[model samples]
Target: MPPIRYRVQANGPLRGTAVIQGAKNAALPMIGAALLASSGQTVLRNVPTITDVANAVELARAVGAHVEHHPADRLLIIDASTVTSPLLPGDLTRRFRGSVLFLSSLLYRCGEVIYEGAGGCNLGTRGLDWHYRGLVRLGARIEEKAGTIHITLGATAAADLYLDTPSHTGTENLMIAAATTPGRTVIENAALEPEVVDVARFLTAMGAHIDGAGTGRITVEGVDQLHATDYTVMPDRIDAGVLCMAAGITGGTVQLVGGDVLDAFGVARHKLEQMGVTLRPEGAVTTASRLGDLHPINIITDTHPGFATDLQPPLMALATQASGTSYIRERIHDARYALASELTKLGASIVIEGERATVIGATELRGDTVTAHDLRTGVSLILAGLVAHGETVIENGRMIERGHADLVARLRALGAHISREELPDTTRP
Candidate 1:
């Protein structure tokens, strides 16, 4: 099979409506949480058909769960009643970072799990110290040998857990681990992202008792058992932000359908408005358009209710079209500036000094060949391509498919000329 790449040409203002996909961040964790149920089938609606979710489904099957995925319908039905395997295949687990989320489920089901760690995009060092510490406090035994980890759980007990930073995956793993442990477990400095709240609701629907999900503190009361239930994943705020920026960059208007973007994009909505993009909410649909001159804005990425690190890349691309200089401080990931050089390939003037990036804009951008270093970076380049003067070719475009579902089709629906094509097998020898 040939590698895939994205070819985009400068199109006029993107117009029409775009229905946001289900949250990839929310869907992956909930898929892991579904394994907590020993009987009955867990039906998940509004599941995005992304590569990460496909990897999660394969990981679930590797551990003995029977999964039925209907991508056309955006649904997943998982039956983990027969799960008895403690070994998570290194081949499958190493595909994406979400593989680590299976730890709590496998440990709870088989009393032991042998893992080869986790893998994802190269976004600096992401250690699992918090996850290990919280699990140890919950009475789990962990040992490392020759690059593999062995975890064993015995008589699960509740304990107080604290995170040095409000890690999203760390919070979900601990919450799921404590769900059936038979006592109340409290987590301090917990992640308040909406995805965390969605997972809590899913667990609650499965008979787990939880409180304070969308706050800094979360409490989970362990139950004797959890049963399967039907749940719907939340809309992807990151995807919505990208589409909104698509409108901003192209100087077009677009309507986002499916959910309330106002609630999902907390502080980001205001930031977009500051950049001269008007976002109007009409119940479940929100309209994004830019009719005035693009203005430069300062951004500092942080936890929820603050600017999102995931949306920073797309915003950086948008900043190149704004007048004056736009400042971006990436506080979450150290190597987020990987998109700087790629954006420069398309005539973007970006200066990176440590974690801070300064983008000088209103420079007539001309399209050029660029690389998609990661998921967000890939989407950022696409946004640049939509407004560039000529044709733009984005290499390694499959990375974008990991997060966004029906990306090309959706963008085309919004009146953008973007297409996915096969790259020749140049390495064939």
Candidate 2:
């Protein structure tokens, strides 16, 4: 197979209903938690069919666990009872940073593991100091040997630990570390993302006592053992936002089937409403469109309950249609402003000053070939293509497919004229 690129033309509007898949961020950690089950078959329902999930299955299988993925059914089965390794596969582990979450299970089960540098989106310097330092505080011994960090779990029972940054994986790794450790552990300043809550629920279903998952503080009570059971992953809020932005860019109405409007989007839902985007609430489903001219609004990205940085890319695409200047402050990430450069190729007038970006919109955008630097950036370019004039081609969609499920198929279902084709890789390693 060759490298994939999406060719999109302005086909009028994106008007239809599409069901969003399970959250990738949520599924990754929950898959890790499945390894904590001492016995029995751990079944996960509504798992997203993406490359990252497939790689995670390989990661699990590499550790000696029996893993099965049923993409047609969107389910995953893991039998970690047979897991017999402590070294995580470096090749697959480096593909995505969430691979670090697997360490919690190895430490809790095997009591020791060796790992090296983690990898993920090219956002500058996502420090694991919060994860590593937090784990060490909970009685785990850490040794740095020949560029690899060797972690040996000496004791599990602990009182409380606090994350200075509320890292999502930090909360999860700690939760799994405490799950079978024989005592209650309290975590302060925990990540408030919905994915973090879902992982906590999965652990609770496996007989771990957990409280305050969606809040800033969380408590986990260790159990003597964990048994495999059936679990469901949460819906992808980022995908729902992308669909909504897709509709907004094309000036059409699209109903996001199975979108958790309130829980997932949080502050973003209200911001879309404030921007003259018509949002009709219908239980877990909502329809979005922009009949009137969109108004620009100020947005600041932060942790959960605030405007998410993950949504910033698509929202930036949406801002191009707004009638006035849109002020966006990217406080959470340093290099996320990279998209402004790519969007500029399509006639978007954007200027990045430090962590802030000013999008001068209502600009006439024409399609051209663009590059995708990361997952959200790829989605952002596709969103721009939906409304662009003439033809737009996005190169190197590997990262996009890694995060989203059936992106081109889902968009085509909504009446958009988009086709994905594979082209030979022109660059050499």
Candidate 3:
């Protein structure tokens, strides 16, 4: 597939509904964990059609899972019972950092495995120090080669694991490895994101003992064998919020169907309210209302219960439409401000002060050529393109398709001007 660019033009304010997709973050790791089950096969429904999902599926197949994907049904099935150790391709693993999660599952099943350096969105140095640190504490002998990190599981039980940064994937790597070990393992300062809880629930369904998944601490009691069972993935709350921003910014009302509104999106609603976006209670189909005048507000990205760092880039795009200056402080990924540069092309004035950003609203934006730095940044740029005057061409559109399925078609359905065009890689020249 060649590189893609989005040609976007806005309608007289966006006026329609946009439904959310499955949680990309949750489904990727959950599908990866399917490798730990030896008795039955795991089926994942409502998985997103994104690059990360593709990466996870490829990793599963490489690790010896009988993988099958049904795009129409949005389902993925994996039978890892006959799993084999195929020396997970280093080139493949470097595509997405989530591949690091496989280290634990593979170590538990095969006792010895070789892995390459983790890769994902280039958001600065996302070192695997915490992951390796946690694994070493779990009695795993580790060595680093040219680019692969080989892991060997020692004959041992569980131990207490403390995360220095509450890394979600790191906690998951250790949790999955500890599930098959004998004895108790406690993970302190564990990530409390809903996706983290989903990972814990999947492990519990596979016979692993776990408690306090959606909290700061998680305790796991190792089980002998994990049997597979059917499980449903949680809704994509971040997707819901991003789409909601699309609706609100366009002066349109949209209903996010089939989602846990209060649990997953209550904080987003509260944040939007500060910017003058209102949510009307309607049970399962919640409606979003926005005033023509959007005021700037202060936002701090943190772990779950606070504004999610994943939605920060898209939300920053929304902030561009606000009336006053908005402050956005990103605690997770500092380099996330790359979108600010693109937004600036659309007449947005954003000042970067360390990890925080101050954004001044632009009354009317004139579209121009912009580059997408990563997945979320790509989609956020697309959103900006929808509201910009004239044509907005988004470079690096493949990143958007990685997380969002039929994104251009979906926006078109909502009456936005959008189309995907292939662009050549000029760097070769």
Tens-digit lDDT string for candidate 3 (1-429): 578988988885655666667888788778777888876778888888777888889888887888898877789988998788837787778788788878778887888888867777888767788788777877888888787788887766788989888777877777787788889999999987888888898888778898888888889888888878678777788777777788777777766665655477646668887777777656656677675787888888887778888788888898888888889999888677889888888888889989989988855778999998888898888778778889998988887877788787777877888999887777675
Model 3 stretches astray by more than 4 angstroms: 424-429
C-alpha positional error of residue 300 in candidate 3 after TM-score superposition, expressed in Å: 1.4
In lDDT terms, how accurate is model 2? 0.86
Query: Rank by TM-score, descending?
Result: 1, 2, 3
- lDDT for position 49 in model 1: 96
Would you list the C-alpha lDDT of every candidate in the order shown? 0.93, 0.86, 0.81
Model 2 C-alpha lDDT per residue in residues 46-88, reported as the tens digit of each score? 8999888988898899888999899989999899999889888
TM-score result, candidate 3? 0.96
Measured by TM-score, the strongest candidate is: 1
Clashing pairs in 3: 50-402, 51-402, 96-119, 97-119
Cα lDDT tens digits for candidate 1, 174-282: 9999998878999999998999999999999999999999999999999989999999999999999999999999999999998996787878889999999999989
